[model samples]
Target: TKKALIIGSGIAGIAAAIRLAVKGFDVEVFEGNSYPGGKLSEIQLGEYRFDAGPSLFTLPEQVDAVFQLAGKEPKEYFAYDKLDVTCQYFWEDGTSLKAYADLNRFAKEVQSKLGEAELSIHEALRQSAFIYNSLAPLFMNRSLHRFDTWTNPLALKSYLRMGKLGIFSTMNEANQKQFTHPKLIQLFNRYATYNGSNPYETPATLNIIPHLEFNIGAFFPKKGMHDITQSLFKLSEELGVNYHFGQKVERVLVEAGVAKGIRAKGEDHYADLVVNNMDMVNAYKTILKDQRQPKLLLKQAKSSSALIFYWGVKRDFPELDLHNIFFSDNYPLEFEHIFKRGTIYEDPTIYLNITSTHKNDDAPAGCMNWFTMINVPNNQGQDWDQMIAEAKRNIIHKLNRILKTDVESLIEVEEILDPRTIESKTSSAQGALYGNSSNNKFAAFLRHANYSSSIKNLYFCGGSVHPGGGIPLCLLSAKIMTEMVEG
Candidate 1:
């Protein structure tokens, strides 16, 4: 039997294991933590449960695809409900909007709430849909490098139409031109953070994210977002994928420009293929020490990390939905604080997610679980404790002002995740949520290829590699990597 060694048990690693095992390979995963699901995890605080990462689930079809590949019905292993109310927004300027899953209702809501042009909304979505249909086959479903980029006609069309992908202009620039309302613009601009990029700096191509959420629709798993990992783990286990918990891969064993296997916990395990689902940057600096490393890939601009606080509230608010956004007074200024100054903004745009709205069992009866997050710079030797202290005070004040409630007294439990801890735990470079920032126009192409062109039998799949981060993309990255292996 062919042996495939996976370096980490992150979501992508677990997905890759399932793919390879289903394809007739013997798979073994080595994880540093006792648990699987790197970011797609949960934390238990007192009597409350919260999804540690990816609070709002979107594009669940990508998740179901994995079960189908394993020759199983998705409903048998996994299932999710489509959200009717996608998200609720509250701005410091006293603008509130309810985002519905239905386009007509949403447009009518936007018109009544923000007085935005209804016609413009249709045109922008039509444009966004065109972009999604055009690029999904080329950029998302397949790897950019290899023989396909040269010979495949679809890839060639993607290459020719590259300029129109809207990478050159910023998202703010696109929406401002597409619509008349600044509030609508601000609402749409927030999509840049879906991949952990700043709206003011990231390419307008990121506008595609809104289409994915507002048009294609968002969802919530029956259990919680973390159930995505749990269901996939259950599937991987059923497929006979072996897992080693509390095991860390110390190094990638390279012999004469080819990957031999991985060195983990003072022992060398033999394998024909070494699939590294760890962060791409760390894969080079730590594991590929003996090989010639690409200086450009190492120096690629990284995406912004986040400072998140998981608060178990003692009460629930009726206004909040599964997803809520409390906008800062100056949205652009917040991005400046992260990208330009490399510092956390005092009044950052706060994202508040209450999964208990849908899954009330996540918390005690009459209470809520809040996953509050704000974009911050990647780890660069900042004083996180001090920054976190100031941010908490500011966030509570901001939320109280917008939500018109006493926010502080409701917090019954708290857990914080900063860049320093995220880096040390997940091995992501500086704890960047996505591998590289889409700050630059070419960032999509700049991510490390799914398979190494310079090294043989070495591959990558995870948030820190090509096709990008977040739950759906990470799963897609694994699918792309396994396809490369099979071919």
Candidate 2:
């Protein structure tokens, strides 16, 4: 049997392992951490359990398909339910909106609350769906660098409808043109940050993000977000994939410009193919030391990082849901601080995720676990200690003012994850959430392809490589990488 060695045990790595195993390759996954799930891991703070990263769940079918591909029923291994209320949005001006799962109901709610025309909402959604349908087949499912991708029928169709994608305008510009209401514009512009890009600079093609949440619908796993990692890891094991914990890969063994295997803890493990699930920048800088590095690709602008505060609250609020966003009074200035100033905005847009609302066992009785996060620039030698302290103060103040509660006093437990720590934990260069920012139109074509052009039997799968970040894209990266390998 052909042997395949995987470098990390993230969702993408595990998915790749399963795919390769199904393809008749003997698979072994080496994880630096003692446990599986790099960013998708969980944390225990006192009596509260928090999903350490990626709180929002969308495109669950991406996960379900993995198990189904392995000849198993997805529900039997993992299950999730579509969320009725996707998110609760709060503005600083005492205005709130509940984004209902139903399209018509959400439009009516927007009309009644924001005084925006219901027709505008419907039209925007229609356009978003169109962009997703047109571009996803070419840009997301296939390798952008490959000539066959552009020559395919799907690519031909996408090229014909390219004008509707808004590739020429920025997200903010397109949104401002679409809606007269500042709040509605801000709401749509927020999608740029989904890939950690500034709304003012990122191409409006990112507007397709809203369709995934509002149209396809957001979902929550039955057990919790961490269950996604657990279920996939379980499936990989059942498919006869081996896992090595606490094993840090020190080098990618290259012989005559071909990937031979990996050197971990002073021992070389040979394989027929090597898949790096680590950050693309780190993989080049740290592991593939002697090989020719792609300096331009590594030097691309990184996506924004996050400062997350996991607070075990003493009490739960009735108004809060699984996902909630507190909008800043100045949206443009907030992005300016992150992207340009390389600092966090004082009045930052806050995202609060409470898993205890759905899974009662996540926190102790009458209490809740809050994963409060704010977008900040990727690490660039800033004074993070001072920045973290100040950002925490602002976040508490904003939450207190909007929720009508003394937030600081209710914190029974606290743990913070900043960009510095995120980098250290996940080996993500600059602690970027996504590999690179989609701030420019060429970002789609600029992402590193799944297979190495120069090295044979070498591949990459994860947020740092092709497709992009988030759960759905990472899963697709694995699928794309495995397809490249099979060919």
Candidate 3:
């Protein structure tokens, strides 16, 4: 059997390992960390348990497909429930809205709360669906650099309808055109942040993000988000994929322009093929140092990073659910602070995720594990200690004002994950959650392809590669890379 070597144990890498093992290859996964799930790991702070990264779960079919591919029952290994209320949105001006999974209910809620017409909400959602349906197959399912992708009849039809995708205008511009109220427009524009892009500059084609959550519905693993990593790792092990923890790969051994294997800890491991699950920029700079670097691709603007405060609160608020968003009064100015100014906004849009709302063991009785996050620029040698201190003050003030509670007094324990820590932990270049920001129209084509254009028998997967970031796209990158490898 052919031997396959994988560089990381993230969801994408684990998925790829399982796929290759099923294909009759001897698969081995090398993970630098002691545990699996690069950013998708878990952390226990005092009595509270929090998913260290990626709190939200969507497009579960992608995960199910992996088990199905391995001839195993998905439910037997992993399970989740569709969320009825996707998120509760709050504004500083005493306004609130519940985004329901049912479009009709969501439309009525928007009409009642924001005073926007129901028909307008329905139409906006329809447009989002249209964009998703038209472009997902072309942009996401297949490699964009491949000629066969562009020549397909479906691709031609999608291309002909590109004008309707709002690719020419910014997401803010498109939202302003569609909604009369500022609050409604802000709600739609927030979707750009799903991939860490600025709505003010990113093309409105990204508006399709709303359809994934509100239309298909957001979900939560039955155990918690970390369970996703645990279950997938379990499945991979069951499929005979060997995992090497705490073994950091030092380099990708290339000879005469072909990838032969990898070198780690003063030793070499040979394989028929190598799949890199590390960040594309780091892979080139650190591992594949001998190979000619794609300077232009590496130089592309990086996506925003996150500053997360994991708090174990002494009490729980009934008004809060699995997911909640506290909007900044000025959305454009907030993005300006992140993308342009490279700092954190004082009144940043606050996201609080409490898995304890569903999983009782995540926190003790009457307590909640708060995964509080705010978007900030990627690490660029700023005074992060000072920034983190200032951000904490502002975040507490905003939460107190909105929730009518002294948030600081309720916290019994706290731990922080900043850009610097994220970079050190996951090896993501500059700790960018998403590899590259889609601030410009051409960003989609600029992402690193699944397979090396020059090197033979080498492939790439994960957030930094083709199809983009987030859980679903990361899984798709694995699928795309595996297909390229098999072919």
Candidate 4:
């Protein structure tokens, strides 16, 4: 059997290992951390348990497909419940909206609360579905670098309808034209942050995001978001994929322009093929330093990072759900601070995820685990210590004002994850949650291809590479990358 070596035990890496093992390869995964899941790991704060990263779960069928590919039932290993209310959105102006999972109910809610026309909400979602259905085949499910992808009948059909797919306008522009209410526009525009892009600048093609939540449905793992990684990790091991935890890879051993294997922990392990699930930028700079670099792709602006405060609140708020958003008073100005100014805004939009809403034991009785986060610029030699301090003050003040309580007093436990810590822990380039910003239309095409063009038996998967970021895309990245492999 051919031997396959994978670097990193991230969700994508684990998925790739399972696929390779099922293909009859001897797969081994090397992880720098002692644990699996990378950012999808969990943290214990006193009596509270919080999912460390990637709280939102969507496109669960992708995860199911992994188990199905391995001839196992996904439900036997993992389970999730579709949320009736996807998210609760709150604005500083005393306005609130519950984003119901049912599209018709949600549209009616928008009409009732925001005073927006129900037809407008329906039309916006219709556009989102159109974009997703049209482009997902060519851009998402297949490798864009391959000529066959562009020449496929479905791809050709999608290209013909590109203009109508919202490629030319920005996400904000598309939302502005679709809805009359500014709050409605803001709610829709927030989808850009799903991939860590600025809605005001990212191509309107990203409007396809809303369809995933409101249309298909939002889901939470029965155990918590960390269960996503734990379940997959279990599946991979059951498939005979070996894991070497805390063994950091030092270099990708290349000879005469072909990847042979990897060197880690002062030892060399050879494999028939090497798959990289690490951040594309960091991987190139460190392990593949001597190899030819895709400088242009590496230089493209990075997606936004986050400053997360894992707060173990002493009490629960019924108004909040598994997912909640607190809108900034000045949305555009906040983006300017994050993307252009490279600073956190005083009034930044906040995302508060409370897993205890569904998984009661995640917190103590009458308590909640608040995974509070704000989008901030990627690391660029900024004073994060000071920034974190100031940002916390701002966040507490905003939460107190909106929730009508002293949020600062409710915290019984607290932990912070900033860009610096994210970079150190996950090895994401500059702590970017996603690989690259889709601020420009060409970003999808510009993402690193699944397979190395120059090096034989080398492949890339995960958020930093083709397709894009988030758990679903990262899993899709693995599927796309591994399809090129031949046993």
Q: Estimated TM-score per prediction? A: 0.98, 0.99, 0.99, 0.99
Model 2, position 222: C-alpha lDDT score: 87
Clashes of each: 0, 0, 0, 0
Instruction: Supply the TM-score for candidate 3.
Output: 0.99
Give lDDT tens digits, candidate 1, residues 230-333: 99999999889999999899898888878889998899998999999989788787778767887887798788898899999988688789999998888888
Q: Per-residue lDDT for 269-386 in model 3, tens only? A: 9999999999999998889887988988999999999999999999979999999999999888999999999999899999999999999999999999999999999999999999
Pairs with backbone N, CA or C atoms under 3 Å apart (clashes), candidate 2: none
For candidate 3, what is the total of clashing residue pairs? 0
The lDDT per prediction is 0.87, 0.93, 0.93, 0.93
Off by over 4 Å in 4: none
Greater lDDT among 1 and 3 belongs to: 3
Can you tell me which runs of candidate 2 are displaced by over 4 Å?
none
lDDT of 2 at 452: 92
Error of 4 at 20 (Å): 0.2
